[model samples]
Target: MDIWISKIGYYFLNVGIVLVYGLLLGAFIAKTMARVQGRIGIPIYQPFIDILKTFTKRQAISHGIMFNLGPAFRLAGGLGTLAFIPVIYGNEMFSNFSAAGDLLLVMYFIFFGQLGMALGSGESGHPYAAMGIGRGLAQMTAYEVPFTLAVVAIFIQYDTSSITEIVAAQQGSIWNWTLFTNPLAVIAAMIAFLGMAAYPPFDVAMAPNEIPIGPPTEFHSHFLSMMQMNRAIFAGAKLILFMNLFFGGATGLIELVFKTWAIYMVAILVGAAFPRFRTEQAVRFFLGVPMLIGIASVLYIQYWAQ
Candidate 1:
């Protein structure tokens, strides 16, 4: 029972960490983008304030049970994904439920929330919602090609499917990180990271002007708040996954913050610099150069790295 309690505590603790840091980093991105465009940004606490206000909203409507349940599904997905990743490598307290799973499980859990959101949005019967889901799924498929190949390369190089084992292999030296050892895989994964982060050139899923808020077009009040919270948590979870897979996993909270924030900033920087891509254009771009790089990385690992 004590063991179970500890696991539950760690789970909530990690979720809290992701929520707080993710919003702060997200707010920082907004501020940085504002500066880039020659405008003073909102306060760093703006995202927190927005979330609070959303929760305080007194009125809401439901399209159906699924629409009402969509946010819950989305939030669950984010938390479940985070639960599988071993944070603060070598620390038992922060390992959460990672002992029960492996890299493959983590990859599959990444889609749980997305699939839930798709079902909920579809039930809303909004044309824009359906359109956004279509684009998002299509884009996901395009990027997953390179991302999957990169992951495969890592699995081949390490000969393990456990994330903890992979992290253990890279310890004691910065050069040991996959970023240096598997540059091609890193390049391919980082390209997919942009789309995963939902940045410009790949943000067709939420083209406000074109789709008027996309999948969550009809969500408001507390439901919107839940989505916002999930956004921050999911973003942080993605950063942690990349940090574990590419950068050496952090040994301390501070290291985790710095590494994850740096990784998150890459997405922000790319988003600020690029213009949006049409859905088809984005798909084609991922399938082109990035896919080729992924394939090359796998081949290099198989025949050359040995």
Candidate 2:
């Protein structure tokens, strides 16, 4: 029982960090995205406030049962990925939870969340909502080719995809960052993450003009509120997971947060700088340049970098 409590306690700490980190990073995107449009934005806590208000309100509006339950499952899925991902400091405490043979573990969990989000959105029964869901899934398919190649690059280097081992392999000094060692990976992963986060240029899934807020269109009031909160958390957690893959976790919480924030800021800047891509055009571009980068990273890692 004591062992069980300790395990639960360890997992809880990981959850708290990822959730709060996810929320704060999401707000940063909100502020930056809004600023790009020259509008004032809500406070960072606005997402949390929205969540609280949502929980207190009557849950009468969502069209389907899964639509109502989607946020809960999405939140659970997002937190679940934390168990599969290891932050540097928490590695010893959690131990082996991130064990795996290749990039498949990371890739699968990310896909799992995307699947749940799409399924939940589909249950909402709005036409535009369906459109947005379609866009996101289609976008998922478009970028996944390059995304998989990038993972292959890392697998070649570490000869493994166990998240904890990956972090362990990269310890000590910034140059050890996979970004530095495998320059092509840095570029490929950047493009992949942009699509993953649905930032501008690749923001086709929620393209406001194209589909009236994309897959999330039908959501409003409280149900919308949970979606908003989970979206924030999900994005941040994804960022940290990538950071772990390349930078291999940090020695301290402050260092980890700062690094993750820096990464988030880069995506935000890119989002602000580029105009949104047309849905089909977005798919083509990801499959184009980013796909090449992922391939190049693989060749460099497998043929020469070792």
The RMSD (Cα, Å) of candidate 2 is 2.5
Off by over 4 Å in 2: 29-41, 90-96, 220-222
lDDT of 2 by residue, 1-306 (tens): 876677668777777666677877777778877887898998988767777786677755767887767666666666666666766545466442566753466577677766776777888888988888778888888888787888888888888878767777787777887878888987888788888877788887887777888777766667666676567667766777788887667767788888988888777788878998877887898889899889889998888876
Per-residue lDDT of 1-306 in model 1, one digit per residue for the tens? 999998899889989988998999989878987998899998999999999999999989789999988889999988888888888899987887775237887788677888889988989899999999999989989998999999999999999887888888889899999999999999999999999998887998997977887899888899999999999989888899999999989999999999998998888778878999989999999999999999999999999999
The lDDT, on a scale of 0 to 1, for candidate 2 is 0.75
Residue runs of model 1 more than 4 Å from their true location after superposition: none
Specify the poorest-scoring 10-residue window by lDDT in model 2. Answer: 88-97
- Model 2 TM-score on a 0 to 1 scale: 0.89
